[model samples]
Target: MDVRSSAVTIPAGNADLPADLLVPAEPVGVVLFAHGSGSSRHSPRNVAVAHALNEGGLGTVLVDLLTPDEDEVDSVTAELRFDIGLLAGRLAGIVDWLAAERPVGGAPIGLFGASTGAAAALVAAAQRPDLVHAVVSRGGRPDLAGAALGQVRAPTLLLVGDLDEEVIALNQQALGQLTAPAELRLIPGATHLFEEPGTLEQVAEAAAGWFHDHLHPQPARA
Candidate 1:
């Protein structure tokens, strides 16, 4: 499969966020990566997952949600990362930009988020019910999405590490609040980052499958 990779700048609100886009020939869909706080578009785990998604006929956009100046302040204050509303707004703007622009324009959209980014992704899905079709969260704080959990119409998959007990409980609580089609799967022996051997690969495989199933166009019912 021929794949084109490029660095693009996305305008979200007042920020010109940098992103890495990968599109294969005849992609089935495009998934946007929302990284955890302190992580950028270069997050190794997310990059790994994106690569897997690409091989499975999916396009991917790995974007930094914060500008350089904001990152500097966030690094020092550690407060911006927890600002779920701000992050969700920026993600929604990116979704709009992706829909209107480029090599993957008009492709079905999905979101893959990790850590706090998951909360942002959930809220963004709620904000754009018609555009976002699926969401996958990895070791995330979906509970942080608050009341938006009930508003997300997209099908959701929550991947939590079995070793990360606290997060699993939190995800369970959030899962109950979600009215959309959703499921919580546990990765054995993995911690918050899925740093255990072969655990991250499991996450990548599960995420790729979920997006493939949800993002594809269904056949017309007779």
Candidate 2:
């Protein structure tokens, strides 16, 4: 599929968020990535998944949830990294910008979040049940989403690594509260970062499939 990439600045209150958007030709949906703690849109794992989604004819938006100054402050005090409400509010701002711009021509939106960003994604989805079509979390701390889990209406897929037992337990706890269609899949022998061979590929595949299923209909089988 033909794809075009661009650097975009989105207005959010007093701040402007920098984002890298990849739009594929004849796209079906757009996936917005919410970065994890100490990570940005430059995360190799998340970028790999975004590439796969692009190949699958989906548009991708990778944006920084925190400003450079905010990240610098968090690097020192470690205060804002876990601020789920703040991050979710930022994600909602981006969603609103996307809706108004309609850059992808009214395509459905999906959220792909990692680590703590997953919690923010859930909160954002809950806040915009009418706008978001689906949500996918990779090695996320859904437990951090708290009461927002029960409010989310989008279909959610929680992907965890077998060796990431702590996060898996957290995911299980969060899964119980989800009234929406939700699934938890464990990638065998994979660690939290999915650094092992072919592990990250599994993450990409599962994410692409989930978004395909929820954001749009399954591609017709050949």
Candidate 3:
């Protein structure tokens, strides 16, 4: 499949975030990535996952959630990254932009969020219930999404590292609060970063399968 990859600026809230957009020919869906704290669009982990999704015929948008200035402030104070409401509003704005712009030409939209960004993704999904089709969280802090978890209508998949017991527990609690179709999967022998050999590969495979199933669902038999 021929893939078009480009650097684009996306308007989210009051900021214009830099993003990398990759769309394969005749994509099944488009997934927007929300990276974790202190991470940008250049995150190696997310880049790897995006590559897998693209190979699976899904378009991907990897955007920096914070502006350069905001990132500088966040680096110093470590506050903005944890500000779930602000991050969620920006993500919602990006969703609106994607919907109106049709960069992927009407492909179903999904979100892949990491760390605190997962909370923002859930909140954005709740805010745009009719637009976001599916969500996947990796080593995510979904509990930070608070009441938005119950409001989210999109099918959500929570992937946690089994060795990261605290996050696994948090994901389990969030899983129970979710009112939509949801599942919690543990990556064995992995920690929060999934840095162990072959572990990140597992994350990519699982995420691709989840998006493919929900974003490109087959028509029901008559």
In model 2, pairs of residues that clash are none
Kindly list the per-residue Cα lDDT of model 2 for residues 56-80, writing each as its tens digit: 9999999988899999999998889
Query: Over the stretch 128-208, how does candidate 3's per-residue lDDT look in tens digits?
Result: 998899999999999999999999999999999999999999999999999999999999999999999999999999999
lDDT of each: 0.94, 0.92, 0.93
Candidate order by lDDT, decreasing, is: 1, 3, 2
Give stretches of model 3 more than 4 Å off: 217-222
Model 1 C-alpha lDDT versus the unseen true structure: 0.94
RMSD of each: 2.4, 3.9, 2.8
The TM-scores of all predictions, comma-separated, are 0.96, 0.96, 0.96
- Please give the ranking of all candidate structures by TM-score, highest first, separated by commas: 1, 3, 2
